[model samples]
Target: MQRNGPIALAFHSLVVVFMLAPMVVVCLVAFTPENTLAMPWNGLSLRWFKAVFHHADFMSSFGNSVRLALLSATISTVFAVPAALAITRYDFRGREALNALFLSPLIIPHLVLGVAFLRLFSLMGMGGSFGWLVATHAIVVTPYTLRLILASLTSMDRNAENAARTLGAAEWTVFRRITMPLMLPGVSGGWLLAFINSFDELTMSIFVTSPSTVTLPVRMYMYASESIDPMMAAVSTLMIALATITMIILDRLFGLDRLLVGKG
Candidate 1:
């Protein structure tokens, strides 16, 4: 008889508990009647959630975040996928260095980029523009898309494309007809990750945002600066729900494990 794995299961359970605790706490606090967020036992009420729904500023910021995230994710995917194809399909000088350069966004501090963009926008006489925000978000989101798209390209069998070309299919036809479908999973996963990164981004968004063009994270920052209430908890809980739903949808699109941790 085979024995069950005990330590492995226990460790996995602990990790899940740890990851869930903060979200659970925030969800509970969202219903608290008290002004302060405490864990000791207090009566629960739906008042805070009601206020969160009614806030015009919150709705506006949420809409802006969605718009920017969609725009940035699409832009990043289009640019990065083509760049990834070129880098992976053809041998070029400085290949490794160029890949590193594309990934530099991950290393650079977002706050620094924020300030740089602000100064650049001002110098260009385009300060406080929505296009600037979208452009900055695309830059930030590009690396993830490139990484996944490259991996997809690597997983592909070169023989098929060679055969397609041998059979009279053009280079563009080979890519469009054979390669694109195989790479869809990675492209999709990258797009979702890019959108989430843009949605959750705060530091970079601060420098780009104006009163008329603020994202949700910026609104949350401003709100936190002024108040410490259950309303924030309600908003946080809603965000957590959205994140969970997004992950579930992504898992359905491309197996979540394979998307994040490469398949053996």
Candidate 2:
């Protein structure tokens, strides 16, 4: 393997710092003793963090985001598995078209999707409904799950499946015992990625979400527009902490290198 030289290493370190600087600044600002969104240079205080918990709107928005992420991620995973199996295991007319349809969201901008969904929901008289919001998010995140499941299915060895069938195992049994297990890593990784995306989603959500179903990002955006305070910084800090904790849990349970990069 080629090792990075000192210059290359320095450049990469700078890139990492650049990417992380904003988040680091936000977190630090969250600890500020000042009322404004400034760094905690004089001293640190938990006032903003406490305020976030006590704030009804933020808490309600947080709950909505969690439910949305969970439902959308699970729904997408359930659909992606069957769709991936059909695409990878069968050869049929329009097979390529079906695959492209499943992946088209990756190419289409979210802004367009939000507008399309908004119009569709209005026509169906389902505007601002939590159920419809979840459905739209599921559609948006399905491509991520589908791609991961497809990669898992394609890279999987079929010998075990063949052997099981030859041994008189039912097709369903073979799939349940062999195929599902083999693709579990992909399924899990895809679900996590989908959940994260759905949780952090903003543009599409802003259009689809109603007053009652407002998500955290949407709420944060509204708050930022109305005020400039350490409370927004506090909210951002909490989100960053949530993401960090999730990554730590995933790394501990599955090893990030294995789950993310397919390297054990």
Candidate 3:
């Protein structure tokens, strides 16, 4: 057992290295000095980042992405919380099926879903608009919010609400004051997940975006398709940084660990 331990350790280390190697290469190449992609040995510079800023369209796309992410995340969470509460707090016919449908998006392919939405929007006379994009994004991110809120609601005890009701508290009061505070962690976590989902969405956005409604991911896709540039990597790196900052802010505001499987 001891003799094989070193081999196992080395193998796992190799696996990790393999996974990280591409990211390391991307970071290095983003700083390449040459017009075309090259290695650091030739020289390294922040010229690509400057190009990304000077492009101006990149900033527009970034702003659009932020707006879309925030709007979709908030709207999705709003719908998902009520949906989760209804499923968990109230018994009803077809509850199981409803829950399944809410979660089905996670299993469905985004590309296929995007195509379906494009058709649906066309039929409804709402294709290729910000409204359509927001609705589609909300649907895509709904599963994340639903799952988190459902888990949180199930883990939370209803004894407090029952006690409050027995003491003459109204249903709305119990829900808002007691249940909501307890479920805040899951709700916040759901919002974070939804934000990330909408912010980084690609395939769906590609099908639905109009010229004016284009998001950063769609813009990046267009740029990468038309011209393979290091600016793609720079934009991606900025997105990662922003996502990290958002996560930190959310975790600080709401207990990140509590929403999963544990009590705070």
Candidate 4:
């Protein structure tokens, strides 16, 4: 097997450091004892972390973001699974158009979608409604779910399905027993990706969110605009920790290599 050359190894190491530097800095600043955002040179403190918990706006925004991400990711998955099945398993009129429509969000800019959704919601008298917000997020994240589900479906072996059908198994029974299990890894990975994206969404969320429905990213943006403090860094560190924990759990449950790269 060919191994990475010294130059290639050095380049990869630099890339990793470049990507991780900001997160490392934020985590370090989060421990600062000073009121201002800075590295904890003199001493480490947990006051900012405690402040994040005590701050009502941040807590509320965190709750909203969690609920929003959960709902949107699940909703997108529910739709994406069936849509993926139909797209892959059958021939239908306008199949290409249907596939394109579902994936349109990937190409259209979020800023444009946000504005369009805002106008549509206003006309429908649904502006600032949490349900509508969840729907919008589901729409934005659907393409992620769809693509993964499509990959799962396309890569699936058909022999088991054919054998089950040959033995007089019903289509639903075959799907439940064989197909769904095969696609589970992709479904789960897609859901996690969608959830993360929804949780971190900012650009479109800013336009659509009302004060009552503000998300964590939106709240953080507002707070940072008004003040510069270690508390912001603390909040960011916590968010990074959350994302890390989530990925760890996903890796444990599904094997990230298998779920992401179709490796056994």
Steric clashes per prediction: 0, 0, 0, 0
List, residue by residue over 6-103, the lDDT tens digit for candidate 4: 77988999999999999999999999999887889998999899999999999999999999999999999999999999999999999999999999
* Colliding pairs, model 4: none
TM-score of each predicted structure versus truth = 0.89, 0.92, 0.88, 0.93
lDDT of 2 by residue, 9-127 (tens): 88999999999999999999999999887889999999999999999999999999999999999999999999999998999999999989988988999999999999999898989
What are the root-mean-square deviations of the candidates from the true structure over C-alphas? 2.9, 2.4, 2.6, 2.2
Evaluate model 4: give its lDDT: 0.91
Higher-scoring candidate on TM-score, 2 or 4? 4
Of the two candidates 2 and 3, the one with more favorable TM-score, higher being better, is: 2
Q: Determine which window of 10 residues in candidate 4 has minimal summed lDDT.
A: 255-264
- Each model's C-alpha lDDT? 0.87, 0.89, 0.85, 0.91
The total number of steric clashes, by the backbone 3 Å criterion, in model 2 comes to 0
Task: List where candidate 2 sits over 4 angstroms from the true fold.
Answer: 1-4, 248-264
Q: Quickly count the clashes in candidate 3.
A: 0
Candidate 1 TM-score over all chains jointly: 0.89
Pairs of residues at least 3 apart in sequence or in different chains that clash in candidate 3? none
Q: Tell me, by TM-score, which candidate is best.
A: 4
Poorly placed runs, candidate 3 (over 4 Å): 1-8, 42-44, 246-264
